[model samples]
Target chain A: MLQPLRDRVLVRPSEEEKQTSGGIVLPDTARKRPQEGEVLAVGAGRVLDTGLRVPPAVKVGDTVVYSKYAAMQVSSEGEDLLLLEEDAILAVRD
Target chain B: MLQPLRDRVLVRPSEEEKQTSGGIVLPDTARKRPQEGEVLAVGAGRVLDTGLRVPPAVKVGDTVVYSKYAAMQVSSEGEDLLLLEEDAILAVRD
Candidate 1:
């Protein structure tokens, strides 16, 4: 398990046609870029200028929608993953 | 005077060839985009997830270099100004 640091999240991106939940799925054109994923790991929180930490909003196993251009690709054990800041996560799917 | 809110900074951008300071100036290609300016006003701070405020690093009248694409254009009394987040500021010139 990769441990991310400070407001970062490790995500396993969902594949095409397999991202169905709540009877809604992304279109093909939108699916070309990884936008939604399952949260695999979450960092502690963001540090403020005063040294206080702001806890992350999401937790493990959350299905989240993030900004397309905000994800940084990382590979862990032959599996492609995404690393994102807490601010990059746009919404959580119920 | 336009007052900004929530970690936003309002700046009056310097024109081409007029941004000289401390014996350094940005080149023409870089000058095409507004990258440097004098901060006119600043918001209180950024509100953290915990509702704590992170004080701004830059202050009014400071000369700063910022991310070119991060600025939002606003006009005040017919004078064009730029609004940016504190994070968009890359450096403060002496």
Candidate 2:
């Protein structure tokens, strides 16, 4: 039940997919860092100078791709969570 | 004159200050990563489900603080630039 403020999003980072899209296996150190997560919650949105609130693009349960190292890691009740700005989300998985 | 797309912004990262606000000097390795930058340009904002463009929260020439590694660094014309989404900007300096 942890909610973020403003345009921040709460995400549960998925386990890294060790294989590449082309099915190439890499060594532990050579593996690319995971950049995908599942949206758990979203904030009300960012406030603009014009007094308007910008709506978020992603919703709960959506699978999203984010930039590497662009999020904050927080632990709550033994659960691993990621807090990031909405803009960190680069794309939505179909 | 590189313009970012969507909600991205172009920023010029300032040189890292070796001294703290209280005049404490730290070694290079112990120094905190610089998180501040000056906005150089902004995109046309992010699109929403309603097909409306959300106004940006920060404008050109504003000093902003972003996450340690939330932005993409691109070098243009011998100038180091950072491309970050508006949401990655955590706060504006007074």
Which pairs clash in the backbone of model 2? none
Candidate 2 on B1-94: residue-level lDDT in tens?
A: 8988898989886676212323533432121233567889999988876677876767899876555355676888987787987766655554
Q: Which tens-of-lDDT digit does each residue in A1-94 have in candidate 2?
A: 5556578777887766322323432433222444787998887788665557888999999999875344555544587666777987888999
In CAPRI terms, model 1 is classed as incorrect
Best-matching candidate per TM-score: 2
By summed lDDT, the worst window of 10 consecutive residues in model 1 chain B runs over B17-26
Best by DockQ: 2
Error of 1 at B20 (Å): 46
Query: What is the iRMS for every candidate structure?
Result: 11.9, 9.3
Q: Tens-digit lDDT track for model 1 on A1-94?
A: 7999998999888784244423444443232222567999999987887777877777899887554455677899998888998766644555
Give the chain A TM-score for each candidate: 0.78, 0.77
lDDT agreement of model 1 with the native: 0.69
